[model samples]
Target: MAEGRSIAERLSGAMERRDEAPNIALAEEIGASGDKAAVGELVELVRIGTARQRNDAMKVLYEIGARNPDLIGGYCPVFLEALGSRTNRQVWGAMQVLDSVAELRADEIAAELPRIIEAADRGSVIAKDRCTSLLTKLARSGYAEKAVPILVERLKTAAPNQFPTYAEQTASVVRPAEKPGLIETIRKRLETITQRAKRERMEKLLRKLNG
Candidate 1:
């Protein structure tokens, strides 16, 4: 009460109150501030704060990365760890950031492809979607031939829920030399994808691939 401010006011810096922090506008302001330490602060918010805080912090991180990846790129490991978080927000949030910075650190990130594959199997659908995009990015980064077999295996064994998704994403990275094998893998899995909608999607993909 030194200055007669309310408790919420005095404690705002700690952002303990859910209503007090992770405000999108505030996050945007911090992102636009051009402060070099902003990434550190955002990382703290994501790691220690609530779900809303984590989501907003990542939004700002990607927004900053959009302008200059170097500002948010070096924290790739942090984002990769975030993938293991229980919250869907953090998982997909990390994916967005990783996707943004992957080009700059492909070799380092590509090394974690196994973890990435596990996340695709267990994380939220959007998380898996982002994972597929990252995998495709990795494939394009000179690992196409190696990644093709792993992705094909994923497609063959994917649960019905994720069959279409993995199929769709795998199709995008099937290089000309790899298309025949991927097509064969997809065909073998067609009977397993008994769900009509998903089965149709796979069929459409095969048609597109001329398989």
Candidate 2:
């Protein structure tokens, strides 16, 4: 089998050919081997691989998330942005990779909430769902409250298609856990609105008194 070489070597060879099987195998081996040596190669793959290859490399990074989440987490924003810009169906796979990376590297990406929301707001339906889900996760995980404004904006300006998906994600992805239906999400979103209104009202009252 010409494929025979240490897993790293085989993957290097495969990367030269842009071969899928070898890339997939290399991804698996890197995860299993926890080889720090492979990190540079993986990052390079992220830079140069075709859409499929880029997505595949991301999966490897996510798998490596199981071992060194910090390293894996560091790449989430880059991959997320890159994947979001893409229109191919393969972007779904990239979204999945982002999801896994977000889970593992929760702490690292926590500070990028606003950017995440902006990305979601600009994304396709599926990309928006994935980003919103991760945002909800980050919020629940105690990342920050910055995402609230974006969510509110989405609910406000949502089109027919966008609103339903946004509503579904609010139910399925934003909450602490998956809720059964849209009613619950609606209820929760209403609660969020009420809270924001209260805060705004208080600020208005404060301005009147200070004036």
TM-score for each predicted model, relative to the true structure: 0.71, 0.54
TM accuracy, model 2: 0.54
- Residue range 1-211, candidate 1, lDDT tens digits: 2245332222334455455343444434444665566568777777786666566677667666666676777788888888888877777778877877777878888898887777667877777667767777788888787676677776666667877777788888888887888888888888777788888888999999994
Candidate RMSDs in Å, in order, are: 5.4, 10.8
Each model's C-alpha lDDT? Answer: 0.72, 0.54
Give every collision pair in model 1: none
Clashing pairs in 2: none
Each prediction's total of clashing residue pairs, residues at least 3 apart in sequence or on different chains, is 0, 0
Winning model by TM-score? 1
Residue lDDT tens for model 2, 20-122: 6665566666666666657666666667766554556655665565555555555665665665455443354445556656666677666655555565555
